[model samples]
Target: MLVQKNVPLQGLNSFHIVARAQALAHITSEADVKSLLADPAWASEPKFVLGGGSNIVLTGDVKPLVLKVEVLGRQVVGETAKAVIVEAGAGEDWHAFVAWTLAQGLPGLENMALIPGTVGAAPVQNIGAYGVELQDRFESLDAIDLQTGETFTLNAGQCAFGYRDSVFKHSSSGKQDGGYSPIGLKDRALILRVRFALPKPWKPVLGYADIDKKMAEHCTDQPTAQQLFDWVCEVRHAKLPDPAVIGNAGSFFKNPTVSPEQCTDIIGRDPKVVYYPLPDGSFKLAAGWLIDACGWRGKSVGMAGVYEKQALVLVNRGSVDGPDGATGGEVMTLAKAIQTSVYERFGILLEPEPVVV
Candidate 1:
């Protein structure tokens, strides 16, 4: 375990928010975790697990001891006639791992190409893109209990994945009256590794508008995994701002899901509202479309601003190389303002996607 104090977290997070972790520990192995637990000075202290720093906003200095997961490895652990089971350490770069799977001829993750963050964070957020979600490819995951220092594994059903959410995003004593028992692992579990089951009989996930446009421009109906991967990357580059260049978390809000009645009402009010019907008959409304409809694009709140090209993304307009940057408060204030406007117009609340620290 490599321990450090008063570490600057400005560059660690994709948003480039200026902040600090009072105490940060680099855990490269399970042994590192065990060592930290055994130490009297650190054991029993409040803890926080940090992954690629892509899907988080630091509102201020982190008070908990930050465990920066850095364990790294990737390999095909097993294979059957139908699919290949690949395992990767939690700290592996998600996009790089997707590319590696393609290099090895695994095709299931192509639709999610170019997503930022570490593999461990994928399951927690149930990250998705195009038409595929992490839950669709997840096999199992290994994690450690922060409070007990115990290790365990969980399968897909145990993760309770929903749109942009997972058990890992909730607290332990979650609501129990929603026709099922609530199981939230939020702030109590540190994911150590993840496994993916890539099917042998690979089929391309198409029909997304942007993907359809790509196919039309390319003049091809059948796209290979590599082609799909490349297309997704290209489309994302043209749409979403590169975090390295602009300092923003990918998508700022979850596409709100509504019933057909609600959809019809919204459509009646604004026929141009971008939406998609889900397999379950619910309608997914485009958050960016709502924000843009409310005239929030290119708007700013102090150092935080909405991206001019894509209203779905909130960006840091302040300096990336220094202490002067968008405070988490500014970003949240802007986000709340956008939310209020969209709600006032569309009668639906927009849920933020990033974890607020």
Candidate 2:
């Protein structure tokens, strides 16, 4: 464990926002977490667990003791008749792991290729793309309790996974009646590793229009896992801004799910509203389309701006390498404006995808 004071965090976050962690500790193993917890100075201090910093917006210098997870390793842990279990340390880069799985002849994670952040963070958001979600492949995960320094593992049901939500994203008041109800571990447990159950005889998850467009352009019907991975990467590169070049947290808002009655009401107002039917009988509205309809594309507030190509993404219009970048407050301001406009015009409030700190 390496602890540093006043650690610069602009480079750590995908948004490239200028901020500092009052105290930051780079934890490379479970031993590091135990060691940190044993320290009297830090044992009771409020703590913040940071993964790849991809899914967070730093509004100001962080006050909590930042535990930056850096544990690393990956391997095929077990294989059954129906599935192959692969385990990876929490710090593994999500996209790199996806690519690695394809190279190793494991093909189930191809649809979610090119996603940013670490494997530990993936479960927190239940990150999904091209009709595949983290929960669809998740087996289990190992995490440590910050309060008691005890380690534990949890299965999918125990995670309480939801759309862009998980038990890891909520906090508990410690008032539960002896069972894991709604009380969550949010910031109370630091994930050490994650395991995925890649199903055998992988079947392609292809329903998105982009994949269909790719199939049409290539004159091929059945693409292999590697082919699908390549296509998803290609599609995402064309649509989303690269964090290394343009600095952004991909997809700033979650697609709002509405009941059939609410969908009918919106469609009545605008005949061209884009929507997709979910398996749960609710319609998922395109948040980007809603923002675009409200004339927010290519707009800005201070140094925060919306991507001209995709309104779902918010970009940093400030310096990429200096202290002068889009402040988190400015980004939130732009997001709030878009949210209010969308709600006023469509009667649906948009929820932000990234955690704001």
Tell me the alpha-carbon RMSD of every candidate: 2.8, 1.6
Per-model TM against the reference: 0.96, 0.97
Task: List model 2 lDDT by residue over 1-357, tens digit each.
Answer: 467999999989999999999999998999999999999889999999998999899999999999998989999999989899999999999999999998899989999999999999999999999999999999999988888787878899988899999998988825245533436988789999999999987899998999999999989889889989999999999999999877799999999999999999999999899999998899999999999999999999999999998999999987777876799999999999999999999999999999999
Clashing residue pairs in candidate 2, if any?
A: none
Off by over 4 Å in 2: 173-182
How much is 303 displaced in model 2, in angstroms? Answer: 0.3
lDDT minimum window of 10 residues, candidate 2: 173-182
The global C-alpha lDDT for each of the candidates, from Candidate 1 onward, is: 0.92, 0.92
Off by over 4 Å in 1: 173-182
- lDDT tens readout by residue for model 1, 1-357: 568999999989999999999999998888888899989888899999999899999999999999999989999999988889999999999999999999998899999999999999999999999999999999999988776677877889989999999999998733344422338888888899999999979999898999898899989999999999999999999999988888899899999999999999999989999999999999999999999999999999999999999999999997776777899999999999999999898899999999999
lDDT of 1: 0.92
Q: CA lDDT of 190 in candidate 2?
A: 92
